[model samples]
Target: VVDLEAIADQSYQFVEWTGDNGTIADTTANATTITMNGSYTIRAEFDITTYTLDISSTAVGNVIEPGEGSFEYDDGTMVNLEAVADEGYHFVEWTGDNGTIGDLTANETTVEMLNDYTITAEFEINTYSLTVDSTAGGNVIEPGEGTFEYDDGTMVNLEAAADEGYHFVEWTGDNGTIGDVTANETTVEMLNDYTITAEFEINTYTLDISSTEGGSVVAPGEGSFEYEHGTTVDLEAVADTGYHFVEWTGDNGTIGDVTANETTVEIFEDYTITAEIEEMAAEYYQLTVEVEGNGTVDIDPDQNEYEEGTEVTLTAIPDADWNFGEWTGDHKGEDAEINVTMDEDKNITAVFEEEPTDEYELTIAIEGNGTTEPGEGTHTYENGTAVTVEATPADGWQFSEWTGDVPEGQENETEITITMDMDKVVTANFEEEDTTLFDVGITNYDEEVVKGENVTIEYTVHNPTDKVVTEDIILIIDGERVVVQEDVTLEPGQEVTLEYQWEAEDAGEFTISTDDEDDPDPVTVTVEEEDDGMDMMLIGGIVAVIVIILALIGYMMMKGGEGSETEMEEETEEMEELETDEEEETDEEELDEEDETMEEGSDEEEMEEETEEEEMVDEDIEEEL
Candidate 1:
């Protein structure tokens, strides 16, 4: 019999042992015995071990060349590895078993399978794209027009430039976020694949303004101005001394009002506008004519303004009972009509005087025991003049009528007028006075009066009989004497009116009258009360406060009830815990009592067993004997 063992070195494994002539047992085992007879041979064999290269990758990537999953190869074999990433993702490096890889930082590398090894291709989401552009009027200067590649979450600076006649407007984009959209130079955050553009716009046009020699542009004054398309601009021109503005002329614009000095223009493109002006044909002069008294001057042409060296006629036409006196200032004359040459601005005055007339005499005669106004003497007056003669009666007489050349409508009046066309005489006749007194009545009064406001009451006193009387005019309110006018006298056939102010003090209806026999019906005045808003507001505020206070009290009572219930529940839980603790104490006492009883019974059983053993020993000793 022979014993053979297969031994292996590092990175090597034992194979089946080869034998000839004799039977070999357990040929595949490393340590096995080979049974041999005479002329027998046995051999132990070993071979290089194979290894599994487990190739895998993280998310969004895979191994391409040596595909994913485990690949078997001999030990110390060189394997090719290549990692491919999907769209919007990049391979980072090889992860597991880094020491076996040739370049750990490269996506495509070689790995040596020295033993059973595992390798991983790591990838990450990183890169994105950006596209920038511009409009026709301008161009983007920074991060220029093109599609650009950048890492994810990158802040890119942007800038835009405009041409000479244009301007940069804003930055626009299809995706991603810009810091400032309206700014010419700004930044953008590249979160995903984005396309951005810088926009621009055309500039405004300039308007040139000027004026002619006689006038100057006042509004939107003579200058070069810039405005947007289809803008309306105001134009105004002021004329100088002795010159006037004619019309507005423009090179390229639509004028709203061409004939007016102040107008508007619509501008669509670059334009130049001018104000046209011209001088006047002739110099003007003013003819100012004034009259001293009761007359007016009339011009032949009757125009407000006159040319230089123009003749104007002055006719001083007098009013009734008046005559033209004289002309003063530039032309001085007493003629009724005159001519004046208007050389420059001239001021003239026309003075007029009364015409001469024949003199007449007015004699006032008294027929009774009364005095006439002229004392029964003759008076001289001009023709067509009116002379008033009044006849006042004595204490016991009254004026009846006027006779002898009195005015036609004033025969019954105590005061009469006599026209002095010729020599005239007037007589004031008087007679014995009657015994009747004067009649007094209320004429006009306010029917409605506000409280604390004054009301006017008008009363008239008339003497119908041919007598003069003096009495007090009394004003009464609500059947009581409130105001009195003392010493009011009424002549014969004469009437007088008086007024009184009475202030309303209370709010009610009151009667107003005068204390006279011929007084009219009493006037009832209603006094109104002023509105007092503050008292009503104060009462409403008190009621609102009471309501709010009651609501607060009700809410506090509800909260207090809820608190009592919670406190009762807490006290009940505490009582339950106390009862449970008492039950546990009773259970512990019962356990202690059972333990003491068992200990006492165990002692009695030990005593009984010892007595039985002693009796058995005595019986054994008897058998031995």
Candidate 2:
């Protein structure tokens, strides 16, 4: 068992034990006992002084902590209380109290409950509603529509935004102390509620233009009208009939290049724009040029129209085979280049007359001793002019042929006609005729004869025509007249030989020719030294004896008789003739063998002559030494 005792102080007293222990000796005792069957504590109970704490709030708030109605605590015990305001209110202050409190105005406070006390927490309203509105074209941006409540000294931001084609102007109605009154967005300290509106207006501007009397302004319609501010309008000026654009005038709003037909203008304010034009006038005169006579006219700076008093240089261009003639009609000069002034409409004719038919030089040339009737000189004639030219042979010459630009059929004619269309050279060729009465020729005494031998020189005359010709034929040998026939009449196609025999006394080269000038050409002959070893007289005598014997034998063979005995004699004669023939063949064989020795002897003589010449040269060398 345990025992407890109660002790009391001046301000506190021990309270009774309120526990479920084993047992209490006294039911309301300050001193108590508990049976300790296992373990127990005995609590002492005492009755001391205590108080009740009553906390209350004003109409819009409540005491939240420490219970709302009352709180019981022993004397000198501490109690903490809190007061909270309702939706639109705020806590003010604590009014009644019988204990010590921490603060009166604070939402939360502490007090010492020494006795039963009652305290009332006072609260006041601290909120204001904010109302926002705007004009029909715009609305508020922040803390936007409807009512809004805020605490005292709370900051509220208001912004107004305008719709398209409109702008914000100002704010109105129940507005608090605004931060920026002129700005679309502003702020306010909400000590009280606010209701505000944003005003807006539409944007616009003015445009004005005009045109002159001669032409009408096509673009912008020449009027004073309104346009949206800061807008770029296209401005143009179009010319009417017989007029053109000059420039634009007035207004500070400038267009690109005032004289241009199309331009632009920026409208910021009212402006008066004018498009000025000028009247049209003709500035150029007409000029016309014509050509004639197979030619063309070329003009410098050629055009259909030319400025008044302008001079155009005209040149006459002629075709091939033509020439520039005089210039007539509006230009009166023979010069190829002429100038015409364009004072009025000009009609000029470049008179290019046909040039005089081109004349070419026809040259007549004579060849081989001849002359021409047209003369041997270059002569000029018009184109296609017929010229007659005749060729005549001089003296013993006759016209043979023509050459060099002679017509085909007239080439052989002594007379011909030529056209002088172009430059030409003609040659009249001639040849000598056969007018010689007789053909006389002379031959040398011998082709090759030895000195001191008899040589016969022959002269031949021929008459090759159908008639008889009479002439004196003279033959010349070695430049001397050796034979002549005076008054020799040769019948047609007759040939006569007149010969002269003489002893060649010298060894030399000789020429033989006729005395006729037409047959002056000649032949040559050579005479050599005679061979002394030959016996001509003896050989001649032997040949004569042989010829006589052969003649007698031939006579015997020709005789004939009339009997059998005569036949026998004839047979015997035939036998004798055969014998004679055999003997002649033997003699001819002997002669041929002897002739070979003659050629051998001649060769030896030539070798001896060469040896003699060499010896002579050696002697000469010795004498010189």
The models' CA-based lDDT, in order, is 0.76, 0.73
Error of 1 at 129 (Å): 3.0
**TM-score, cand. 2 vs. native:** 0.28
Per-residue CA lDDT of model 1 for 210-275, tens digit only, reads 999988999899989998766788888998766788888877348888889988887767888889
Candidate 2 backbone collisions, by pair:
14-46, 15-46, 16-45, 30-45, 92-123
Provide the global lDDT of candidate 2 against the true structure. 0.73
Those runs of model 1 whose alpha carbons end farther than 4 Å from true positions after fitting are 1-10, 18-22, 25-33, 39-43, 52-127, 131-202, 218-234, 251-259, 263-267, 279-625
Q: Which candidate ranks first by lDDT, i.e. highest? A: 1
lDDT of 1: 0.76
